[model samples]
Target: MRVASLMNVLGRGWLLAERALQVFHSTARETRALKFNYPKGTFEAWAYMTCMETVSAILSQVSQVTFEDMTSSLLLIRASLWEYGLKKLYKLGEICQLVPTSNAPDENQINRITSGITQQSAGGDSEDQGRLLVATLMSKQQFTSKYLELGEMVIGAFKHAGRKRTACSVGLDMAKFHVELGQIEEAERLLSDMCSLYSPENWTIFSANTISLLAE
Candidate 1:
């Protein structure tokens, strides 16, 4: 059947429908060519498997594309994961290892995201671009006064755009940075402001994780 039918039935289910469609298309082509013939349902099964492999490869590529999109969009979850890595590195006390490795956030990946943010910020139309820039900067271990100034710029854009969730996130990141710099009162004020503006569900997990760390 059509991919839309699969989507409607499954609700955000991409993998199964993609695989099935791939297999059906391949098998149908094979049948037309008469290059392969099998007993009754056997061909269909083989075709299904072939479709699955093809779809699996496509899905892998799709995932990478999606990751880049999320990074570009500065989605809170993606930013949180990056922040989590920073925390992990801090815990290991190998803060210098924040540079890209062959694994996560390798240097090339960092440069890509950084360049993406710079380009997006220069373009200056989307609130998401600003939020993403803040998230990316916050994920880094070291910051200069300029970075904090940039964080303020992000906060201003989020507020101007009426994005409470993004504003809260920027606030929370500033709070964490302030707390790390021994500016506890400023951090507390920012956290309090965030709590006032955002519901619990809207609070990013990174903020929750930071609270947990602080409580300990």
Candidate 2:
């Protein structure tokens, strides 16, 4: 059936994004171990660049999805870019170009996703897919004043939808935006709130390992 096929495609996209995340985390750990002694050598630069390219490739693959479909592939790409220290704003511009401006995925679609998933809890996987889409968009948009306006709309919808995890992620995205704009104090406050939402054990360990790069 068409429904089953669509699910399969979305499932594969999620798997690919997850695999890419693992690769990024492993490379980052190796890079960190060599950080202090890493000479400004061509080989070191090449290695770093190669890792970035891998991340970019995976992101591009996720971007191929239609806006109406699962958004998790896109979110994974954004998170991976963030993890790899890619310039979020620049990437946002690239993604905006990929989707037709008039047809770009919007908060309404996001709301549908939130409502569908949170109501059933059986929709957790689908919720993850939707969050990935929002994360991808946020990564591209950064936390500019315009994005902040959009965030307000998104947060409002999340509150109404009752998806606590997605709401927390939207908050985290806002915090990341503040961090990008050099509002370290505000960003830290947002991050503190985010940390309070989940068990410390469930936080992505790979993210903690790459904190230095992400901070940069």
TM-score of 2: 0.29
lDDT score for residue 126 of model 1 = 31
Q: Which pairs of residues clash in candidate 1, taking residues 3 or more apart in a chain or in different chains? A: 100-106, 100-107, 101-106
lDDT of 1 by residue, 1-216 (tens): 245334434543344433444545565687879866433323322332233233333334346565334223233322332233223223222222232221233444345444444453422223343344334434444323534554565565455445667777777777776776677887777777676665455656655654554453
Per-residue CA lDDT of candidate 2, range 1-48, in tens?
A: 133224335644344445555664676587778775532222222222
TM-score of each: 0.31, 0.29
* Model 1 residue 163 CA deviation in Å: 0.9
Q: Which stretches of candidate 1 lie over 4 Å from their true place?
A: 1-143, 199-216
- Best prediction by TM-score: 1
